[model samples]
Target: MEKFKKRWEITQDWQLLFPLIGIIALAYTSYKISNAVISKFGVIAKVLLAVALFFILLRFTLFLFKKLENKWILDQKWEMIRVFIVFAITGSSSMFVGRPVIKLLGITKENLNVFIYWILFIIIGLVFYQILLVFFGFLFGQFRFFWEFEKKMLKRFGLGKFVN
Candidate 1:
């Protein structure tokens, strides 16, 4: 535990939650991807594939950590993990929440052109993504980081005036 904390630069107990959540989220994502790729396979196959993907993803994430370490402004190295987790949750959740919203608005492929429905879906997802990014960042104790991120994003979208 000491080594783990030292490696992550974590001094507080609550900061430990980020690593634990990162592992669980990564494992769950790995399993979901494995199942999608091998729907007809048995449990053993899925488990093995998930394990392979987990390690691959872990390696890729580490690579990203090294690459992003200097690019992003952060006080602690452990905060990078928290920022990533917030991004992961916000991205997945935006789509999940957008589905119900699209349905409620009676938006469907059968009702509209396939292309239009998809376009609307993407737009709605983006809106939710923006909102959820800040929301989850606050929940994860990175509100300032994500708020600044959101402002930049809005600026890129030509909504900078609103942010100001």
Candidate 2:
């Protein structure tokens, strides 16, 4: 535990929560991904797949950490887990928020063309995602990283004039 804390630069007990949450979230995601394919497999197979995916996902996350470490400008390596959690929450919340807004706007798959409804849904979700990303970033103490990310995203969408 001491080694783990030292590795993550965790000086306080409360600061350890983020990494724990990150691991729990990752394990759940791995299990879910495995469950998706479990209909064709037996129980033992599902367990195996989940374990395999957990390691694979862990590896991918570490790869991302390695790649983004230099680019993200963080004071500590552990902050990446918090940033990732905020992003995950923001993305999931955006879809949930957009769904109700779409209904309130009297737009639905039943009324609108399916393709058009999907396109509008994606657009609305993306807009809400932008807002929630910054909100969650501030909440997670990584506002600077996400603010820069948001600026770059806007520039990519040709909304640079507004940001500037």
Candidate 3:
């Protein structure tokens, strides 16, 4: 039992442990939900579903980055880099899902307004990230909630003294 507890503690200390698990969980859950909805309604439904999923996933990824920055795991400049990474992930995922969407809509990529659409998507994603920061700022009154939350957690673990 002691050894097991020790292992758990070590696992938790690994920087990206919980987050990587969360990313996998989110991807799997999104996949299942998307497919279930698509089957129930058909390809026409998947179009709206895909767009909604993309927005929600993008929002959540932004939220995660905010939390990470709050924890000081990433600095302000690094936060910008993280945003680009999230954009890349969402952009690529959209392209993969979108090819089929375009086909279902009886539209060809070459015939579509690709630049305008992607620019709009990128703008919205950026706006969402900004909203996340504003929301977190309002919620915590400037200090990051996760930082304070972690502090409290450390106190619970009798690690508070060491933390400060």
Candidate 4:
């Protein structure tokens, strides 16, 4: 029991962790809701729509901090946000790219129309996915900038060694 308590104190930050947990829960709920909508509307059509919305949300959240004033920035905070943004961008784009390819291969077992639709889906998804890649690349570059900025700030404030 003592060991468990010690481990929990070492790793847990409930205030921070809860918000992340909430966001994850919300995202999962949104996905489930969107998936249901997609299945009802047309599997491919709903999926494409959800993908578009997800990318838009990801892009907006990723860049939202850029609009903040200089005084409002925090090194660790910005790093976390940037990391999440990159993860979202990378994950969404990977899904967008991978899903259609897999589906295309699967469709080849069924019918030519399925293959054609898969090709169309891939082509369309690739267009948006490639755009997302560019955006993600831009964010990755920005992360480097922020990382350097954080280091410089820490150094300037004489808290350099305190930062990790």
Top candidate, metric lDDT: 1
RMSD of each: 1.1, 1.6, 15.9, 15.9
* TM-scores of all candidate predictions against the true structure: 0.95, 0.91, 0.29, 0.28
Relative to the true structure, candidate 1 reaches a TM of 0.95
Residue 71 in model 2: shift from native, Å?
A: 0.5
Residue 84 lDDT (model 2): 87
Query: What ranges in model 4 sit over 4 Å off?
Result: 1-81, 86-112, 136-164
Ranked by lDDT, top first = 1, 2, 4, 3
Among all windows of 10 consecutive residues in model 4, the one with the lowest summed lDDT is: 7-16
- Candidate 2 per-residue lDDT, tens place, 1-164, comes to 99998987888899999999999999998888898988688878888899999999999998998898888888988998898899899989999999999999999899999999999999999999999999999989888888999999999999988885
Task: Extract clashing residue pairs from model 4.
Answer: none
Candidate 1 per-residue lDDT over residues 52-73, each given as its tens digit: 9999999999999999999989
Q: What digit string (tens of lDDT, one per residue) describes model 3 on residues 1-164?
A: 44643532333334234445555655665666787877777766765676678569868877765666555443332333333344344444555555555467566446668886566555454434433433443442333533454467568857789656
Q: Model 3, stretches more than 4 Å misplaced? A: 1-32, 75-164
Which is the leading candidate under TM-score?
Answer: 1
In model 3, the worst 10-residue window by lDDT is 74-83
| Candidate 1 colliding pairs | none
> With candidate 3 superimposed using the best TM-score fit, by how many Å does residue 2's alpha carbon deviate from the native?
51
